[model samples]
Target: MNAPRGTGPYVDAHHHVWDLSARDQDWLAGAALAPLRRNFTLADLAPEARAAGVGATVLVQTVTVADETPEFLALAADSDLVAGVVGRTDLTRPDVADTLARLRELPGGRRLVGIRHQVQGERDPEWLLRPDVRRGLAAVADAGLAHDLVVLPHQLPSCARAAADHPGLTFVLDHLGKPPIASGVLEPWASAVRALAARPNTVCKLSGMVTEADHAQWTVDDLRPYADTVLHAFGPERLMFGSDWPVSLLAAPYGAVLDAAELLTRSLGADAHAEVFAGTARRVYGLPGG
Candidate 1:
């Protein structure tokens, strides 16, 4: 084993923080994700992550509601470990640019580094290609923050088209298009992922894949193919490790997840390992301490 050094100073590119008391994450209350229905605060995450040596975290928005991002920004401001916020903004909104501007003025709004729309939940494979949606994404790019894509495997083609359309924007793909690892299918998902990775402006996050598999029976090896596919497609420089935190709890513990990623990258040269484990996230998200 490479036995890579500590996780401190590594930029955990994707994670989430939420409070059930503040608003209902209805999706989590459903059977598939009921375990995460309760509140998951920064305080709850910090200690567990700290044990893994994680210095800073990027708090991603879990809901599409307008208030969710602002709430996350406030949480980032209050927490020392939260170095950035990848908040959500309705890109299809007529005033997306203005909305992002407004977001910048909130408590930890200045920590805002990117915007993400839960395109995966929309279910329309071409959802990202809608003209108005593209316009909003363009605005997000035109503004300066990176655009994080959360989409399903079948949507990768449209995502590629969107990435091509907005070369000026930095695109971060969440969960490697969330390949169907549990079923052992790979062709289309693998091919599409490679195509998306071909875009110089795009990057991929190695996260959330466990839950996509058999959440109750997944093992590190079950996640290996998806991870291996993404590593080959995006390479170490464009790839980054993300814990996906509270949400990942449904499948594995934080430390175990971190260890899996570490083990996967063990054979890489020191510099390449650093890039995947930390460097890439720092540059892609403009994280501090780079």
Candidate 2:
């Protein structure tokens, strides 16, 4: 069962935690990302989550390495704030199912609700549709887990096609396909979003938008068109909220991110507000006591 509907008690559908000593995050490169080069722990996030009324969260993958997922699952096992985890794995590997099974048997394994590959970083936009990747996605379905799409706008068509190819697996689209809100453009993105949402097997996370916008001067109005596009197309029930956390710190504080999401969804009415903020995450991730 999904979480109960309401105006509060939110579920953050996406966030990440990392320790540099634990493992190197090769993606945290460049001078612009200096703020995130340090370790971000659950201890650092707990108070922030509590302050924002984030009752639970889905800990997402930061790198393509296998060590990160088990590390995240172990973290989830010890913390109540993390209700589920979307970990990483080599989706193209022949023993992908065995790897998932091994992950499930790890310390924090039961909390493993989904799998995500950094498809956006892949040079090929059609990476998700590759036969090996599709077979791995099918194995994820056989294991009863959801798959997350962390692709860019240009890669969304392939994501949609992959979702169609693997009807039994639920595809969770992270960050609204990473829209170009900073540029105020919404074409190819909107149309591609519609294509992905057309599949019942797909859902989207209303996350990472603040970072995508002009961080220093972003307004809720600037974020509206993109949010409304997903809200109206996928509806609140198919969309879940995610803070993107320390990554969001590059743009706004945690509270500001939640405030912006609330502002955008104010017209969704009470029930829908609850679904977008918490219910959808609970349903899709199968968090316990939902």
Candidate 3:
């Protein structure tokens, strides 16, 4: 129940944890993602988060199974560090609302604040607009959960349209829609992201840039354009910070991620900095304790 207090107790709005023994993360298959193949429980994240002054965090889903969300809720119920869980459910399922209700009735169900899907993995850019998906999203909105968008650059248009159509739901864009930072190009991605942000319901996370860039040689300067674009598009209140955790381990350590975020957002004033680091997350994901 710890809240954001003083200049510390920052909220990390996005991170992930998985137990390989419990279940396999099919997404962590590639050689490039081999580093994340091992188990990463909250225990593994707690020290780094605490050292970084991260008092609360929203644990995001890595897989698209119904079982994973319940496991996440159970983990949240037990962890002092994890204050919220943004889990996954089959959004295309007709029983989405009922499934969501069942999730809420679980152990840490009260901590279920948001839902996410592997929208980036979908080949079709307009998947969010599908009738079944829209219905599921409405169910999530009715449940009062924010929807975390993890789509590619081309998917931004549909994200914007979905947000416009589902005004009752809040859209939290993850990883800046996986910007093309490694290529050092910002055209279509930048413009598309701006269009998505134009929707009042949309918010963006300043996360995953290190991995998005040339992982081995990425610099804070390399991430500036994307970060700046999001900063300008969403401003402080509409923008939040996320570590992207285990995935971030591929590019940089935990503290380094926070350091780069600090450097990228140095231009913002104290209040704005606070918002990006903590306040925005607390507000957007509705993380517990202020």
Q: Please give each candidate's TM-score.
A: 0.95, 0.96, 0.96
Question: Model 1: per-residue lDDT, tens digit, 1-290?
Answer: 22456435677788987777878887775687878888888888888888787888888888878888888888888888888899888777899999999999888888899999888888688998898898898888877899898898888999899889889988999988889988988888999999999999999998887777787888767888888989998899999989999888988888877887887777788888888878888888888876
Q: After superposition, how far is residue 209 of candidate 3 from its true place, in Å?
A: 0.4
**Error of model 3, residue 187, in angstroms:** 1.1
Segments in model 3 whose C-alpha atoms lie over 4 Å from true places:
1-6
Per-model C-alpha RMSD: 1.7, 3.2, 3.2
* Candidate 2 lDDT for residue 238: 95
**What are the clashing pairs of model 3?**
none
Among these predictions, the greatest lDDT belongs to: 3
Query: Model 1: C-alpha RMSD to truth?
Result: 1.7
Candidate 1 TM-score, C-alpha based: 0.95
Per-residue lDDT, model 2, residue 234, is 94
lDDT tens per residue, model 3, 133-208: 9999999999999999999999999999999999999999999999889999998999999999899999999999
lDDT of 2: 0.90
- List candidate 1 segments past 4 Å from native: 1-7
Give the distance in Å from residue 184's predicted Cα in candidate 2 to where it truly belongs. 0.4
